[model samples]
Target: MKKWKLGMIVAAAALSVVALAGCTAGKSSSGADDKNVTMWVHFSKEDPEGKAMVQNITAFNKENKKGYKATVQYIPRSGSGGGYEDKINAALNSNSLPDVLTLDGPNTAAYADSKIIQPLGKYITKKSDILPSIIDQGTYKGKLYAVGYSESGVGFYYNKKMFKDAGITEAELPTLDKPWTWDQFNAILKKLTEKYQGPAIDMQLSDHSEMAIYSLAPFVWSAGGNITNKAGTKAVGYFDSAATQSAFKEIQDMVKNGYTTISPKQKGFQTGKYAMLMSGSWTIQELDKQYKDISYGILPYPVSPKTKKLVSPTGSWQYAMSASTTKTAASGALIDFLSAKAQMYRTSMANTVLPARKSVSDEMMSKVTEPMRFLIKQNQESGHARPVLVKYPQVSRTFAETVTKATYYKENPDISALMKKQAQEIQQYLK
Candidate 1:
């Protein structure tokens, strides 16, 4: 999921305009032949995710009846819009895109609108088997353009020992069906703070990157609010609405009341300095392999007291067909093969990512740990895809900035004004 963030090209506007002007739709450049199909990925071959991808490609070449042989070039991203994205941008300008490529979830609309990628709804064989959240993130304007192999989710990673020490029993803990509300979660935080005499949770507040919005947006949605309209064309009213304000204010109050800190210590939960940590699926791997000193469990996202609705975030890198590809049949076959149940399960298990297919998750329940199964269930039931917009990078950055700004209670006491300023900045990107 973190890698997916790098796929959010900073020069999306330029890519859109230049690609629209330069690309020859339904035309093939180099890299694809009658039998050879080429693709680009954002990870090195040595990476576990990349390794799994290679295995899938090998399996596809051996098993597919179409006799399509696919090869991948790994241009690992160095920074936001570097390496793989840099290559994609240059390729878009020069009209040299490969047959298939991997793109982040949020960039689907921009790529589709600029004719960089073609829709894949008709080509997908197992559309019904794939998670709706995965399909939701990959579709643009009612057309499926991409398919995610894995999904992502954010939740509460609590210290089991710390909870017990605070007199909070296991029975008192929340579940997927009966998740804690904002008020209920706050009460637990207060008790933990009193018992520990320090911060109760680490929200990773100082992180000013994609993580800010990736993890925090669920709070707004759970409050029955949104960052933009359904069409994703406007943000002012939606972003600065009362419901959105209430969500941030509750978090702001946490910072002010010492329930959580703006600058959390590294591995605070594992080291027993914090009772809970707000993080994503990646942390599960770290906790299991690197930080085994503590007992822990993952909890579903807390809902707003008013709405009592549960929502968690979901997005990841996905496979899409380049519009420039003349090998549409072979390319679509490769995509379906990569996103199918067997490959999805393999990559998800090998990479420790959530599977994009319901069947994959169900199969995983028999093999994966309880916490992993819980995350899979929450992702399937409550996952909310991020907004699909052409100017997603700019809009996402502004929304993240708002999260950081709102927590600075003494510096910015008025939530409405802060949201308004952030909304106005995002509006520039929308226009």
Candidate 2:
């Protein structure tokens, strides 16, 4: 969401928010038994993803394994406008956190650091089956605190018709074996801008929360810089590094050269307002469904000009148990059941997300649609989770706000100075 969106959520959530509603009896109701494991899942019950999960839980409950009764408490899409964070914080403070819950990819660290969730590694033994990036997304300070059943990935999507019109051949486009260097990519953006009267690429710059962090961090990664250092301790040299500066400079250049606007366009690529886009795999489904007339192609993220490395973003929603929940056995059982190979395939297939487990992903490749298979393959090979740090929220918000500030004005930011300021701000939140 955009900062305004988040701001509205936080401000409104300050009054009343529905973090969890309906059958939230997981917090040890009067007659609740040990078999009652409840989940506070964020998906709207009206959506297909939510409906499918509810159905899965219903089926699981039908089994009555050990007489367990699994239930779901629908968490609103955006609670009181603060989104998930505010709702969750309220729930935690009220001592009403659900026994099992789902968290976005980058939030594991925040919740773990706050002691809202517990380490889950001991509950599952088949961690090897899960993608390393998926595991990394859920880990905090070396301990696994969460695990996702499915994954999400991002790629550079292009308008094939625009490419053809610009005299760009398939060979010129970056391939997995040969991603475009930063220079090559900038040159192409320039060409696209000159050839197309509209934007060259859709940065989706308007939304500044998860979208900002998920899409932009990879560029920093490709440049061999990070939101935080390797030890996950500091952002000083990393966020303010020369490589990181160079990366953002290119982004600023794209804006300065009229290749992309500082704000997201309304269906820019789909409507031919933009020639390219950096988007999630789910976009393929949206395009196919909402804009079947448009011809588009997907490619790996551009590599760093200096490092020649590709780091594609990966992480979606994952389930984590509440640290204070007493029903470990039942809650763990529900989590394991959710992440089971068959269940992963089922839910991921229904949701169009990549399965986290290799076995489930392979099965999906063989059985799911071509686009789904393609995304699964990319996720398996090139996926990289966001920096799992306790202060990820601050880091993400700072970097996003910095990027926006850099592009908001006609003049670009002083890279080192702005980055240092951002790094310093993030440093203050390290403890």
Looking at model 1, which ten-residue stretch has the lowest summed lDDT? 23-32
Question: How well does model 2 score by local distance difference test?
Answer: 0.81
Q: Which residue pairs come into collision in candidate 2? A: 9-81, 9-82, 10-82
Q: Estimate each model's TM-score.
A: 0.92, 0.88
Query: For model 1, how does the per-residue alpha-carbon lDDT over 350-379 read when each residue is reduced to its tens digit?
Result: 998899999998888888887888899999
Candidate number with greatest lDDT: 1
Q: Residue 350 CA error for candidate 1 (Å)?
A: 0.8
Model 2 bad stretches (over 4 Å) = 1-32, 63-65, 79-87, 408-410
Q: How far is 416's C-alpha from truth in model 1 (Å)?
A: 1.7
lDDT of each: 0.89, 0.81
